[model samples]
Target: MYRERASRVVGGAVVWESVSDGVAPVRVLPDGCVDLLWSSRRGLLVAGPDRTAHLSVSGPGERWVGLRLPPGAAPAVLGVPADELRDRRAPLADLWGPSAAAPAERAAAGRPAAVLESLARDRLRAAGGADPLGARLTARLATGVPVAAAAAEVGLGARALHRRCRHLFGYGPKTLARILRMRRALDLARAGVPLAEAAARAGYADQAHLTRDVRDLAGLPPATLLLG
Candidate 1:
């Protein structure tokens, strides 16, 4: 049987929880806000305004769907300038969806894991459309090359790439690279590797660079999340 783990952060006005492992995707509650999400498995993610967070129940691929307005709409939904939406943090529930709250409650209640699984399946059914640009972006990210080089490889001019990336992922190439780099570092850190070694292998300039990226993207120091 596959095991599952989850963690919650409270104490602020916004409550956040993340669930991982097992086969089901966690449902996120809609709290009327935008969210920033990153997927560790495939380097795929979505940042947008939404009412719920849904996951694919049939498989473990990192997939997400939601409604995001054009860059001009960022200020209206996220309370930030259009450019800032790429890096800003909003309420997790508002960004992901209403269903996210359910798993936390279930886990707290010690309910059977299967209950969450069912919810994931249901959410997956509701998740629609494969964002074409998102798919292209993930394919480029998997190559582990620099963004400019990746954009060239994909036949997109620098400006064109920036526009498309912002339209689809809510961030430009640099921000997405940082997010992916941190995710890669996290995977390495979890594999029992030393911090320096992991940082090097994951393509950071140094351990300090990796540390800074981790803190920025995950809102915690690397050692706390990676080691603990």
Candidate 2:
């Protein structure tokens, strides 16, 4: 089973989950968010922004606590380009090395979510905060704004915008738009919107468009995602 809640200290969500039976495949759908995860058995790992469903298998009796970082925060907080860890689960030691990794390891022991927030704040204090432009771009894209217009609004040309997106979000603007659209559709459906209306509201050409995107991003059909 799994349970999650919002974090007051962090920009996104935090979750605690347990699995007691034999290892089972867990479909983690794309949401353009990065997760800092801790397991009693496996220690600290960063679950990177995914372009497709990430099927995770956990050991029996495994317990996990995770903090999901909002886009644009990962690079500043995790001290790595989003592109470097895209579609990957990486050991914190690999990026930060032993000295920095030691503190993160210690943080895993007590209040991992709060520790993650503190670490992010400290990193921002030293390295400066996430790009303000990136945050603005994310907001624009989340509302289905065209990439070209978003780029112009942010005063960046196409190539520069693409490069900045790779650094800040691990993918180009188009991919980020698709992920944001999918999340918006799911949120609408979960809130009891009809699938057809949700698709319309989320900027899809039609329900089929929504279905195709959901299948590609989530590995599930919209009907199954909403009703099952």
TM-scores of the candidates in the order shown: 0.49, 0.91
* TM match of model 1 to true structure: 0.49
lDDT of 2 by residue, 1-228 (tens): 677787653455455555545456777888777887777677778898999999888877877777787777788878889999899998777777785566666765677656666666677677777667667888899999988999989899989999999998899999999999999999999999998999999999999999999998889998886665
Error in Å for residue 33 of model 2: 1.2
* Lowest-sum lDDT 10-residue window in model 2: 8-17
* Residue range 16-115, candidate 1, lDDT tens digits: 2233444664433222223323223322123442212233342344332223222223333333333434433343345446645554454435432333
Candidate 1 residue 88 Cα shift, in angstroms, is 8.1
Most accurate candidate by lDDT: 2
Residue 146 lDDT in candidate 1? 88
Candidate 2 lDDT at 151 equals 92
Worst 10 residues of 1 by lDDT: 7-16
Clashes of each: 16, 0
